[model samples]
Target chain A: MRIGIYGFGSIGRLVAREAVKRGWEIVGAIDIDEKIIGKDIGEILGFEEKYGVVVSRDVEELIDADVVVHATSSYLDKVYDQILSLVRLGIDTVSTCETLSYPYYRYPVLARKLNEEALRYGVTVLGTGINPGFLLDTLPIVLTAPFNIVEKIVAKRSLDASKRRKSFVEKIGIGMDPEEYMKALREGKLTGHVGYAESVYLIADAAGIHLDKVEERQEPIIADKDMIIGEFKVRKGEVIGIKGYGTGYKNRKEIIRLEFHAYLGAKEYEEIMVIGTDYEVRWRSTGTPGDQGTVAVVLNIANIINDLSPGLLLMTDIIPFKPFFKH
Target chain B: MRIGIYGFGSIGRLVAREAVKRGWEIVGAIDIDEKIIGKDIGEILGFEEKYGVVVSRDVEELIDADVVVHATSSYLDKVYDQILSLVRLGIDTVSTCETLSYPYYRYPVLARKLNEEALRYGVTVLGTGINPGFLLDTLPIVLTAPFNIVEKIVAKRSLDASKRRKSFVEKIGIGMDPEEYMKALREGKLTGHVGYAESVYLIADAAGIHLDKVEERQEPIIADKDMIIGEFKVRKGEVIGIKGYGTGYKNRKEIIRLEFHAYLGAKEYEEIMVIGTDYEVRWRSTGTPGDQGTVAVVLNIANIINDLSPGLLLMTDIIPFKPFFKH
Candidate 1:
């Protein structure tokens, strides 16, 4: 298989590394980083041997591949043109964009346009990752397969912020006053997490249930005692990280709830509870690596995206959740 | 969609109930039970009204259905002719026979013949249930999606026989002399469980790894103290139930291990641990209903069997475990 890597950041590099191990040809590398442009892909990947492919700003560099993995940004607006440009070139794309996981949830107009363009050009497109893509939505849908009916769903993903890298920890507004963190978050100066609504709708849509209400919020998880977390010193009643949640309702009855948590010294694991009439099952995971899991999801979908129907599709569209779909 | 039920036992009735809830048309019911034959399915199901379809010994009753769920016996030898007769009538089938999950494991010749016949008649045939199908095999494959390289896998399904029906508890040889239970089990008078080898092979096939050795064993779980279980009285040193295991080795190194425990007081849950190089993750589930899960597996696969290629397939074949396949 021949593949290309777009947006050569942490995730893109991870994909390239795993792809090479599979013996797939890395046809091209597309990135806007001025520092890496014009360098051999092998050098940027820290390999002693240089691959013929070079990191280039031109999208055409990826035109020769069977599929181009677009891992640009979280929001749809930020990566809209980049993904469309690839679609215009008639290339199948398995992107890591969080919003694109459920484009219609927040970008109905753009999603429709992208779908039309994909159909016109005859290429497939998908957006997925560990959170909006699997842990929160896809896994829950799979768990509901054994039930004749599903009444409600609750999922929580908790990862220790102290274990994450510096850039990822910074986004959660670590080690700040709880009130100040909320104020900055309200003013749009900080970004806690994204794709809560996407996951809520993804689960509901797969269940074929229409939601009357969907709401999301992010809050600070204050440390209760003096302790050390990474480089942070002792403190009490201070913001350590954030806990975000999304809730969906049907006819004023709660149907779905998803929680995303990342805090210093937090327990790292994911739990999903799916309840049916007189039945309930909980599926828990021994935490997943965010960036590593993103690489896996993107490449796994890339392996089969070419065989799927052409259009802008969600992860649930091709994951084969037929049992829930029947409901 | 129209469907048919080939066995009117516990699983068949469960499937019929859920299928009706989906509003599917239950075209016919076929069974060899002399007492139930010729009776209206609805009446036998304890419904207030009668369904026109009647239980019969003839396969023609299922000819009109888009798919037929064949849930008679566990071993392939017992149900091969039954399934082939349906395939001859150009009807797709989803069977709950445990041995048929990986037909080639114990019946390679029969598996190959069934595949040829399925292709000749252009229909899909699948064998699936909770143990051989999902909990031990399919679910583990799905959990391996995030890893770059997997080294070993261990899955366990532990259920409390005390909470199960009497018939189920009887099969586990509850309250029997440990020595007598072992002798009876060896002499074929008692059947504890089947499908360990099938699950091992299914996992191996998805990971694209060939096994050098596969071994399975069933041992009695002796009671440690006197206690009441259901209607039976167990004393210390008596057999409470059984603990079965299957292990697969590659090049003298163990690669897969699966344990199935059904004892009077066993903890009720399922757990799967997949370890990759420098990475490991565990997925656990609250206890799943064996019979209900079988019904779900059959119907879920039946829902999409028509769209699949014509042949005998395993759960791994359709569940989409590309990440593992890449290995």
Candidate 2:
């Protein structure tokens, strides 16, 4: 099958290399960076420059491909309009945009517009990736499949932030004053990316629940010692990280609480749980070096695109969500 | 304390007797039945007459007591106006009406108006009962306190239908046609009660989650079997029960799903779960005879009213939610 990478960012390049390794043709590449435009795809990805395909900034040039992989920026509210424009032109698309996985929860109008446009063009749109997609959607479905009597579902994703990028570290308010970080969060300026709410919606939709309410909350980090990262210095007892969570209720009663935590210098763990009348099942895995688990979960759904129906699909709907590596 | 019983129903009589047992003076009782209007409270309750206070149909007379236990009809919307009128008179009030527990979820405007009036008068108004009050609200909170790091919360309550009342059996279509039952549910004519949604909301509030969406769903009975109770013959394959659930979401993701189940002639079980990083805790209790668990939960809360805050409260917010009876 022929494929196109819609943005030449780190994730886009990684997906491109993976697709090529799987015998799919990298027919076209798109990137707005002048430094990489017209350059060989392999060179931009730090691979030995062997593939003859070159990157271009032209959207029209890449629109003709069989499939498009959208590993672009995380600011979905700004890029979704353009993406929907491409979707309207009959392109099957998969995105890593944080908000796209369950856009209906946050951007319902945009989600519906994209769905309608995709249907008009006879294409499909899906959002899939690490946290919201895997832990929230896929893993819960997989863990619950063994039981015939499923009662409740819960998911938790925890990460240590010491090895993360500087941009992420700074945005999470690590090395900043505690009060200032809280102020920024209250103003919605320093809050984490939006998708945890979408994850709850996706899972509830899958489970046939008409939820009454979904709530979000965050807890600030309290550091006991000063820490430094790059040029920034964080004081003792300053806010260094956040733990974000969402809850699903049936008839105004709590049935599930899905938690996502990211920290600057902390321990790591991710778990998905299903509670039933006679049994309880759980799946947990520690974060690997460089967050490879995230990449594995995103790519695991690539081979099953044909089975997915039209409209917006989250990771739980697309993949078997079982222990892929174990299988 | 002087207490008056409004409505000569089963719950009203029981509460009055319980109050008498606690040494509180029964000022009088009120009901619409003309035959019982002039009768003594003990005589109406099938006990030898002792308390000289006679039953009256007058609402003004009922409101004259220091406290009014409003255990009137179950249809709250029809009687809310009168209840509010009583609240406006500054009388401390408690009701057995299920809808009053989370009035905001069902009738937001009325709940707000009643709360405003109660606040203005500095008089406490509470909606209390077994299912919505204790099972959904108080149970989940008490289960989570031992855990150091809570990642998820789920509560489930299930009961056998054989021991339920005629009203519950008929409402769930135990002896009726499936088509009619489903139609009634879809039209919102067969809503079992209103507090399940409120229970989830109260739990989320206590857990410190500000959910964006709370969804509710119902599961109709689809099994094939005949259930016979007294002279009533419930046909095979008819809905003998219903399951109601709610979930709360944050950041577009699900964090909790709360469930309540009522069965007229089935097996019985109730469970509460708390999923955390180091421990997963679950509390399970079997249903008592004649739907007595519900009565137990309600009476248990009533037994601790003096220690409880005077204002309205959810199950999780109450102190006695922990294991009240050690087996």
How do the predictions measure up, each by TM-score? Answer: 0.94, 0.47
Taking all chains together, the TM-score of candidate 1 against the true structure is 0.94
Model 2, residue B134: displacement in angstroms? 37
Q: On residues B230-251, what C-alpha lDDT tens digit does candidate 2 reach at each position?
A: 4556677877678788887767
B30-60 per-residue lDDT for model 1 (tens digits): 8889999999999989899998888999988
CAPRI rating of model 2: incorrect
Candidate 2 residue lDDT tens string, A1-327: 677778887777767765665467887888888989989987776777668889988767666677777877665687796578567756777777878888877778888888887777777777776656655665565444333335677887777777676656766877667788788888977866456777777777766577889998886877778877435566788876888888888766666678877776666666667665444645454433332333333443443454456766655454221211100
Relative to the true structure, candidate 2 has a C-alpha RMSD (angstroms) of: 19.8
Model 2 misplaced regions, further than 4 Å: A228-233, A288-291, A319-327, B1-327
Evaluate all candidate structures by whole-model CA lDDT and list the values in order. Answer: 0.86, 0.64
